[model samples]
Target: MVSFLFLDFDGVLHPQYDGEPTPKEVCFCHLPRFEAVMRRYPGVQIVISSTWRQQFGMLQLRAFFSTDIARRIVGITPTYPADGPPRMHIREWEILQWLKQHHASNKQWVALDDSQGDFRDYRHRVVFCQPWEGLSEHRAVQLSKALQGTRL
Candidate 1:
């Protein structure tokens, strides 16, 4: 199956650690765990579902990861001008919009996000991550199961 992952960086990868003057890289405490899952599932393609894609653009965003993970990134989610304001959190809308463009009906997909809002009907597809813990072993197990078409 050609599975796709809609990735969120701030919460899913690590905590936002709001206003602490921390460098961006300092927030990523779970790359090894994340990388382990990615290594286990090399077939799954990644789409940038994080707002960081808007801030830094694709190339720079991909630069945040190792070269191997970078190759798995198929694309970034689209932002619509009609959706209004750059800072607005219309992420679920953007992910769905990107899915629409890509003909997603037959695809297996999942979103890793920290927020509980904004999913609507697609709530079943989300695997909630604990922001404070990042991609802990427990959440990684959840992610793996979700990708394997097991119960979320």
Candidate 2:
């Protein structure tokens, strides 16, 4: 069974913005549906796997979920290394590393992100979303179906 749902904040939960974009600056449209889905599936872990860590740090997590349910989140994977240059690749690496550390294979979880490049190996496991679009009813339905074992 899929035990975890890894989320990318900018394109999946919040609108993708370059400058002046903070979690507080963006609105969460599909949060109600997301909460509904979560309520329907207990014990399923949700992890923030976004690059916001590199841009805004850990505070972004609380800021993003400030008005929504926060208890569902289990962990977060930061986008950049503490001492290295900022790179989106770090996010993907961190995700894979996290999965490896937890002994969870690709089939056991899902990654919802905007970038569809380097993650080709796990493409079947990822739910790719457009950069400017946040979560929508279709994506929520897709997530619900995937959680129910229908891959898409």
Best by lDDT: 1
Per-model TM values vs. the true structure = 0.85, 0.75
For residues 24-88, could you state the per-residue lDDT of candidate 1 as single tens digits?
66666777778778888898999988768878977898887889999999899997667576543
In angstroms, how far off is 11's CA in candidate 1? Answer: 1.2
Backbone clashes in model 2: 0
Q: Please state the error at residue 144 of candidate 2 in Å.
A: 0.8
lDDT values of the candidates? 0.79, 0.69
Candidate 2, residues 1-152: lDDT per residue as tens digits? 77888888767776677654646646566556667876777767877787555566445576656344566676776444578765555556777777776777564787777777747566777777777776777877777777766894
Model 2 TM-score on a 0 to 1 scale: 0.75
For model 2, the superposed segments whose C-alpha errors exceed 4 Å read 19-25, 54-69, 78-90
Candidate 2 all-Cα RMSD:
3.6
Give every collision pair in model 1.
none
How does candidate 1 fare on TM-score? Answer: 0.85
Scored by TM-score, the top model is 1
